[model samples]
Every structure is written in C-alpha cells, then in structure tokens.
Target: MSLQALWNQFLADPGRILNDLALFFTLAGAWLLLATRRREQRATARLVPQNEAQAVALDESTARMNRFFYRFGYGCLMLALLVSWYSTRL
Candidate 1:
C-alpha cells in the first residue's frame, strides 16, 4: 500500500493507533521494571562491603532506584489504561 493510503487509513480510525502505542509502552515499561530489578539483585549479591557506611549508602541508593522504577512502571500502566479507555470511547 502507498504511504498516502496508509496515512488515510490511520486518519480514518486513529483509536487503533493510540491503542497500539499504549500496548507497546505498557509492555516496554513492565519489561524494563523487571529487568532492572533482576539486574540490581544480582549486582547487590556480588558486592563485597568494604565498610558499614558504604554498605548503608549502597542500600539507600538501591532503595531509591527501586522506588523510582516501581513508580515509573505503574505510571506507564495507568497511562496506557487511560489511553485504552479513551480509544474505546472514541
């Protein structure tokens, strides 16, 4: 199909495009969250604490990163849901 025809098709029903985009982001966010968690866990396991202070700092940083990832992943999911809902209503 020609580029113009593809564009016209999308323009006729833009909801499909939004829904697909939301689905893609939803999956990507979830995968990123899981992968980060696993990687951090492995790194933490291999770490040899040279001092108590350093270990505490590392733990704090890891906690902060974990919280950030959780929030980011959930935010993406919520946004995707909102987009999906809107698309359905369109």
Candidate 2:
C-alpha cells in the first residue's frame, strides 16, 4: 500500500497511535540520554597531555550538554506518561 494509505489505516486505530507515540518518545529519550552520556565520557577521557586545559573546558561543555539532554529526556518521559494516563481516562 501507499504510505498515505498505510498512515490512514494506522490512524484508524487510536490505541495503536497512543502505544506508538509512547514507545517513540520513550525510545527517543533513552537514545538521547545514552548519546549524551557517551559524548561526555569521551570528552572527559581526553583530558591528558598539552590539551588538558582545552579538554577540561570541552568536558565541562559536554557535561552541561549531558545534563540538558538528561533533563529533556526525563521531561519527555514524564509528559508522555501523563499523556498516556490522560488518554486512558478519556
């Protein structure tokens, strides 16, 4: 079937939509958190030799980014959970 046809079929089932959205947001948030953590770790590990100062600066930046991503991820998960709960009540 065409993409539009498939989308229409998918939307015809509200339960599927809710479940898919919940799964999507959860997975996306988890992936973002993992990626941010990995980047922060790599930046921290680079603090050696002549680049120690620069590495420290980069590590701090990465840490900030990691914190932002972690917070964002948590917010997304919380919002998604709230939405799912609200949907169930309706």
Candidate 3:
C-alpha cells in the first residue's frame, strides 16, 4: 500500500495504532528486564574477585546497572500503560 493510504487508515482509527504501541512497549520492557537480569547473573557467576576491594567494586557496579535497567524497564511499562489508557478513552 501507499503511504497516503496508510496515513488515511491511521487517521480513520488511531486506537489500533496506539494499542500496537502499547503492546510493543510492554514486550520491550519485559524483555529488557529479563535479558539484563540473565546476563548479569551469568557474568557475575563467571567472574571471581581476587580481593575485598575488587569484590566491593564488582558489587557496586552490578548494583548500579541493576538500578538503571530496572528504572528504564519500569518506565517503558508505565508508558505502555499510559498509551493503553489514552487509547481506551478514544
């Protein structure tokens, strides 16, 4: 189909598009959270800290990453919820 046709279709019913956006964000957030958790677990399992300082540094780094990823993933989920709610009001 042509771009014009797609645009017209979208204009006719934007709720469908918003629903799709919500689904995409929901999946993306869940996948990001799960993938990063698995990756971090595997990485930490394979690494061995030689000293107390090294262990502390590793722990700090992991905690920092966990915070960032969790925040971003939750943000995506919140965005998806907002989009879904907005679509329902349409």
Q: Provide TM-scores for the models.
A: 0.70, 0.65, 0.77
- Tally clashes: model 3: 0
* Model 3 / residue 13 / CA error / Å: 1.1
- lDDT ranking from best to worst? 3, 1, 2
Clashes of each: 0, 0, 0
Q: Which ten residues in a row have the lowest lDDT in candidate 1?
A: 49-58
Q: Model 3 over residues 1-90: C-alpha lDDT tens digits?
A: 999998998899999989999999999999989988887777666675544356623467777988799889999999999999999999
What clash pairs does model 2 have?
none
TM-score of 2: 0.65
* Model 1 collision count: 0
**Candidate 3 segments whose C-alpha is farther than 4 A from its true place:** 47-57
Candidate 1 whole-model C-alpha lDDT, 0 to 1? 0.81
Q: Pick the candidate with the highest lDDT.
A: 3
Clashing pairs in 3: none
Q: Residue-wise lDDT of candidate 2 within 1-90, one digit each (tens)?
A: 899987897678766677668778878888887887887777667665657555355646666767889999888788778767755664
